[model samples]
Target: MKQDIPAVKQPVRSKILVVDDEPRIRDACRMVLSEQGFEVALAADGNEGVQMIQQEHFDVILVDLMMPVLSGFEVLSHVREAHPDTVVIVITGYATLEHSINAMKRGAFDFIPKPFTPDQLRAVVAKAIKYNRALQDIADTNSRLRTMVNRLTDGVMATDRDRRIVLANPAFLHLIGYHGESVLGRLIDEIHVSDQVREMIGQTLTMPSDEFTEPTEEIACSDDSGERIVRAKCAPFRGRDGSTIGTITVLNDITALKEFDRIRSDFVSMVCHEVRSPMNSMMMQIKVLLDGLAGELTDKQREILGRVSEKMSGLTTMVSELLDLSRLESGLIANEKSAVKMNEILREQVSFHAENGRRKNITIELRQPESLPPVLANQRNMEEVITNLVTNAIKYSPENTTVTVTATVENEYVRLSVQDQGYGIGADDLKRIFDRFYRVNDQNTRTIVGTGLGLAIVKSIVEAHHGSIKVSSTPGSGSTFTVLLPLVSI
Candidate 1:
């Protein structure tokens, strides 16, 4: 009779080592395991088994207790001490309670009698292989986790419910002037480094978990290299059950960011001062020459002087805006409130910007006031705000575009708006228009002569008065800027 058989898919073969003194038992065991898809190696005695284990890796080891050269107990001890992850099974005819207990106490996986069946032997080996794979997985996961925590730049530390440090990364050890051995198995508050650091940790631990956020403060430290700044934040540490066990703190160094801001602000102030002194002198001398105080000039010479004066005027406007920006950034500008009428300020600003309007033939229109509210604000700052807005509208609008200024009183406050017909700002540039030195880098805005300080100053001056300003615009259309101020002291 002929029979058909189906093929069974098998997992990768597990490795096994068998050490027995009897040749017949070894050959029988090898034949049975080889058919079961196991890679088996043979060792004659306990001594030979130990030598093979020392040189190769195996998932399971089977040893006979009664052997020459070395006993099974001695080999079991060596395997447990050297390769604890390898599963070991002891085989012996002397299978008494004392022998089984002794093998188990020496870390044996299981014990088998001398007259064991093929099924019983395969069952024991399969159980040992399964247990070994679990241990291998756990060890591999721990190795990967350790590598991540060890190489983190920001210091990471965790404590237990008893408030004792359970884990500290390498960065944490380096941050607080302590070695890894010193920080482990120690108390967090017991750290004797910076008092500020200790206090920060103490405060964070006592606070509710919801209250902990990012870095609370930056600490200044002077070292051999120079001054350094470090920021620290602490929050609740969780256990496997998602319950707060302790606090975890992270420290980041940010000395360079703070230094860069300081350097940039100082450079702006210095350049403005250095350039303003000489430019002011040149303007005064040129004014005298144009006024004919030096000599009467011909028509051609007069035209040339006028052109020079117009270019000088543009420079003067830029220098003034730069000075205003420097003052705003340095916190030198103050808002000392005085009673001011919106209608009066708007009329004065429109008159002052009349020449700018004539240059582009743009009409500056102001709605005639009926009843208007007065706000308490610094007169100079209030005037500067209106002037900057009007000047920008004039500079950006095309020929004969009408710029309208409107004033109204709304619920104990006054709303002043300046609307213009010009090429509007793009969405990306609109958000950053008031940032210092941020000019739009597009075709419509690049040709305009500005130091990018006009809108920044306008924003600062309006904010200083405790007023709010907002804008809405569309591309190819125009923009409307509205400023709100308290009708009475806010």
Candidate 2:
């Protein structure tokens, strides 16, 4: 998965200050920005804009070139002095060549004409906001790097190509059981406890390529105390002359992830071993009765056997769902979208579950738009989504409650809804209902045994379709599961 830092507090609302001598233009800009989810602050003219700049930081400032008392240039200059970090955009009623050039030379992030369309203004503001955000991100990265260096607990040591000490932290000396001064000028190979490990490190350093190769896996070293493991990562450092100066290495103790991986592997093996036999026996007996291989029975006896068969069928469904969910969580699901009639596919799956609902005295209704559009999706994948949702509705609903399934075309997309009035999900459990192995705690639900992967599988299927699913419910008022899919032209 692509990892990026999560937005801190809804992206700071992209604060924008619009400065213009005309209140009408300022109000117009404010309304446009506010509609686009930006936090807007208005300032009348350059002087007032400067005052706002001093009072608080604005992410991006909009300055009108022609203003009374103070021109846009003056406001830009004051802001550049007070806060060079804030991006300034020149908004002018009259687009003059000289004014544009002057604004550019004076460090304006971008320029926009006063008679600009809302879309044009939006584009300029987006660019300015992105620039400001990039600047802040760079600053944050540098701060984090400095903090990492300062927080090292071991005696850290870094050397250039000439073997001269370029960086050294106090922890490096203590970690090596040596005086800090003694290790500063010492070659890295001079301090090792194992000749083999030292030779490996030497070979890595002497390699012709400038790229640094960190040991990909953990290695253990037997010191006087006991066995200790260290994880090492290295990256080449470059100088201003574009030459590889040396390598930076960070070492960490990794006894936890290894131990956790071992325990997890063992637990999985144990679970698989424990579950395989009973599930197999249940399935074998079900097949025998399903094939009429067992002794002949009367209608009531066959009905009783059918109930047993249904329970085993549910179990099998759960196990299959669990396996698929494991694959998705492990990132084993591939991207392979195909054109599919979403409503048609959903209708077919709903028929199977509708029969199950009928057996339990529940009514399952399927609603499809008259002219449903095809959606880009995976066929078997979306069937699993619909099945899981409808099954849950059937499972939770009262004996005679109607479970309505609806698919409608809406704004270039299709929404599939499954509503049930069995026992509603609580707000707390509703949040985590899609998480693997999550089950609601209550009397009404504990009777229904499940593998807890049904909703999780449904969530994964919806996401794999590049769509989303949401649930809304009141504790006593029932629940609704809605799946949204983008419509694709055939």
Candidate 3:
């Protein structure tokens, strides 16, 4: 039985055509070309050669100048007009300087003397094959790149150092409201870009180098394409010499994303308002009943009603938080900032949560040096952030565990960290702990009641003040929440 084996890969062969009236010359040329790993074809004369050229594609062609029926010059002329990419070499037994000059003038790649050695022929063919392969590769690469650029959905453009448009892909033409004409040699400012995009482009071009600015991602506006949100980025297009050649800008349309956000924001505002009305009514009724305005109740009845009031209060707090978050997102919240002593704020929050902590048998401890640096932040926002952090620490900690609030000065910022000894958060849950409505769904903390918006609110408030917040935690050990705010320079 024949053994089952993979076939050896064959190398790509360059095709060569030999056109000579003499059979001896044709056979000799074919043998020399084939030995050099080329696929060889032959013709008895110039007429036959022209016919073969019309029928097939060859990388290199060897033609004899003098032939029957048709002269070598005619065949060369026809091939040059029809298949200019093919490498053509002329060979003849009757050699002359005029013959070589005339052959080269007719677009012959090389002129071989009569009675040429096989070595000489092989050397010429080898050089032609290398040159042909390089040209073909470059053509293939350019074709592929052009296809890729045309198919892109994101707009891409390149401009010269003087800001003249050098290249614009199809998507870019659609974005700037132009087509058909090659915009390569046109000035970019003359293009029909919408006013908003033009202003952004102007900023990038003319902004002072001393005044550095962050690259903006999205801009919303009306254009010929209707409303759109174009997210663009620009970079210095560089040359091989490591110098700035121009700028390349890429743009992506995010209109759908902006629309979705608008709808979601409106929906949240509507739902929160609807729920608050009924909740406020229930709270008032609960207060009336707790005050004995309804009827005298037994000890158990009062206890149950009291717990009902507490639960109602928690729901009310959550609703208020939702309203606050919605207002913050909508930019409806007034940024009334002032000099805020963080130490005083921390004391106030701890005192307020003392009663709630007592219910859980948890204690709040404050740890900081005297005369802490004041932070430039909204007083109300700071209160909310501190309260949320302390409340969460107490809520998650087991009975008798103490929650500590620490303040310190670091560089130009005030760093406040809240540490708690609770059923610690897992590594995975810790990552998304501050996400709105994100909770650690672990067996250990499943019984813990939370609205899941507390930490998210804290983070939003901290960032709104141009500060930052972060959490550090370990399973079965504990977690620490830290907030950093820029300290008001004296």
Per-residue CA lDDT of model 3 for 1-490, tens digit only, reads 9999999998778889988898988999999888878899998988888889999888998888888789888989978987888988888776788888888898988878778899999888888888888889888998898789889998988787787887789898876567656788888777776665555455555544322222345656566668877766554544565455666677777677667667876787787778778878988997888788998878898899888877777777787777677666543343545457887888888889989989988888898888787787778888888888887888788888889989999999999999999888888898899888888887877766677888888888888778999899888777899888997532
Q: How far does residue 411 in candidate 3 sit from its true spot (Å)?
A: 33
lDDT per residue for candidate 2 within 296-387, as digits (tens), equals 77788778877787777766666566656656654323333545777678778877777898888999888886667777776778887887
Judging by lDDT, tell me the better candidate of 2 and 3: 3
Top lDDT hit = 3
Task: Tell me the whole-model lDDT of each prediction, alpha carbons only.
Answer: 0.79, 0.75, 0.79
Compute the lDDT for candidate 3.
0.79
Candidate 2 residue runs with Cα over 4 Å from true position = 1-274, 278-319
Question: Per-residue CA lDDT of candidate 1, range 242-347, in tens?
Answer: 4457766676666676676468657866776787777778888888988899998888998987777777777777777776666665443323344577787788
RMSD vs true structure, all candidates: 16.4, 16.8, 12.7
TM-score of 3: 0.47
Candidate 3 regions with alpha-carbon error over 4 angstroms: 1-13, 18-28, 41-56, 61-124, 127-131, 159-167, 182-190, 194-225, 267-436, 441-490
